[model samples]
Target: MTALHWKLVIDAADPHAQADFWARALGYTVEDNGAFIERLLAAGHAPAELTVEAHGRRAWRDLAAVRHPDDPYEEATGIGHGRRLLFQRVPEAKTAKNRLHIDVHAGPARDRAAEVARLESLGASVLRDVDEPGGRWTVMADPEGNEFCVQ
Candidate 1:
C-alpha cells in the first residue's frame, strides 16, 4: 500500500517541554522511543551526541511527539497511529502569527462560554471573540502563544 499518514510537526525551542505541555493539554500520551534509541546505541548506529538523559531515560533531544489518548500506539516504541503532534527543536522563537492554526471543537452542548472558561483554566488566554452571521468562535492562545479557536 502507498504510504499515507497525517502528522503536525511543530517547531519548538524545547521539544520535550512542548510535548509535555501538549500531552497534558490534549490528554495525549508522550511517545517514548527509548527502545529504538537503546538499540541504535547498542549497535553503534546512534552517536552519543544525539542522545540525552530526560526523565531519567534516554531520549532524542531534538525531537519528541505526543499522540491522542485513544489512538492505537506501538507498545515497544510508544508511537501512535492517529492524531499525532510531533515537536522538533529549533533555535529561534516564534516571530509571527501562525499561517495555519488548530481549532478545538468542544461541541454545542458545552457552549462556547463554558469551553472558554475551561480552556482559560488550562492556561489558555483569550485572544479575541468573533460573532459573524454564520457562526461565532473564540480565539485563544496556548501557553506558548500558539493560536487556536473554540467554537
Candidate 2:
C-alpha cells in the first residue's frame, strides 16, 4: 500500500485573497506557480485570461494555494508536496455551516487570548467562547465566514 498525496481544497469567491489570508494566518507561504504559468502560456497551452498577476507574478486567476513553510515543494512549479491548502474560485456563495473545520492550537507557551486577538486583527471574528471540562476554545469565523477554532 502507498499513501496518496493530497491537499485541502476550499471554495471561495476570491481565491487569491483567501490564499493571502491563510498564508499570513498560518505562517505559511503562498505557492508562486509563476514559472509554470509562464511556461504554459508560452507553450500555448493556457490562455492569458486564465492568469492574473499576484505578488508581482503570474498565478491562476481561479486558483491559489498556501503551504507550510517547512514543507517540501516542487521548485519549478512552486507546488507544495505536503501540508497544502488550495483555494479555488466558485460562483456560488457559502450558505451553510462547514461540516469540517480547522482547530488552531495555541501551545502551552502561548496565550490563547492574545492569539485570538491577533486572529481577529487579521479579519477573523470571534463567534463564541467555550469553557468545558474537556477544554476551552474560541470559535471564530474568517473573513469569508469559514468557522474555525482557536484553542
Candidate 3:
C-alpha cells in the first residue's frame, strides 16, 4: 500500500493573493518554488506562460500554496509535504456560500476577542457573531468571500 498525503485546495481569483492572506492569517509560510520553477523553465520543460513574478520571484501562475512553519518540505522544490493549503486560480468568481469552511481554534489560553481582532486586521471581515450554549464563535469571510469561524 502507498501512503496518502493531502492538502486543502482552495479556488481563488488571484491565487498568490489568497495564499498571502491565508499565510499571514495562519502564521504559515508561502511555499517558494522559485528554484524548481526556474529549473523547469530553463530546461525547456515548462513554458514561461505558466509562471509569474510573485513575492519578487517566479511562481506558478495558477497555483500558490502555504504550509506550517514546522513542517517538512522538499528542498529542491520548496514544496511542503504536510499540513498545506493550496490556492488555485479559478476562472469564475465565487457566487454562493461555501459548503465547507475552516474553523480556527484560538486556543483556551488565547483571548477570542483579541484573536478575532487580529484576523480582522489581517483582512478578514466579520460576517456575524454567534453566541450559543455550546460556545461562542465569530463567522468571518476572507478577502475573496471564503467563510471561516474563529473561536
Candidate 4:
C-alpha cells in the first residue's frame, strides 16, 4: 500500500496558534488528540520531554492539526480522514517565496474580486493581482504570511 496519509504539513514558529487560526479561517476544527496523548503518558510510552501544556490542556508543542468540518474523523483520537492541515514548529522563518502554493477554488459562481474581498475580511492580504489573457487570479497571503491564490 502507498504510504501517504496526510494532505498538507505547514511549517510554523508556533504550531498550536497557527492551527487555531487556520481552523477558524477555514471553518474547520482543531484535532483534539489529547486522549491519545494521555494514554501514552499513562502507559509510560511517551517521553516527558515531548509534551507541553497548551491552552490549559496537554498538547504536543511541536505539532498540531486541523480538519475540514464535514470530513469523517475518529472520535477517540479526533483525527480526520479527509482534507486536513498539520502544522509543525520550525526554527527558521520563511525566507523566500513559496515554490508550491495553494489555489483557492471558490467556483465559477464567484469571481476573483468577490473572493478576494471575502478572504481579506478573513485575514488574507492581497500580494498581487494578476490578469493575463489566459485567466486571472489574485495572489494572497494567509494571516501568517503563507501565500495562496484565488482563481
Error of 1 at 3 (Å): 7.5
User: How well is each residue in 1-151 modelled by candidate 1, as lDDT tens digits?
Assistant: 9889889998888888778877876778888888889988999998979877777788998998999988898887777889999989888888899988878887757777887887788778999999999789999987778888988
Better model by TM-score, 3 or 4? 3
122 Cα displacement, candidate 4 (Å): 3.7
Q: Which of candidates 2 and 4 reaches a greater lDDT?
A: 2
Model 2, span 1-151: residue lDDT tens: 8999999999999999889988888999999999999999999999999999999999999999999999999999999999999999999999999998889988899999999998999899999999999999999998899999999
Task: Give the candidates in order of lDDT, highest first.
Answer: 3, 2, 1, 4
What's the lDDT of the predicted structure labeled candidate 3?
0.95
Q: RMSD of candidate 3 to the true fold? A: 1.2
Give all candidates' CA lDDT scores: 0.85, 0.94, 0.95, 0.84
Tell me, what's the RMSD of every candidate?
A: 2.2, 0.7, 1.2, 2.5
Q: Judge candidate 4 against the unseen true structure and give its global Cα lDDT, from 0 to 1.
A: 0.84
lDDT of 4 at 12: 88
Model 3: how far residue 50 lies from native, Å: 1.1
TM-scores for candidates 1 onward, in order: 0.85, 0.98, 0.95, 0.82
Return the lDDT, model 4, position 81: 88
Pairs that collide, model 1: none
Highest TM-score: give the candidate number.
2
Residue 140 Cα positional deviation in candidate 3, in Å, after optimal superposition: 0.3
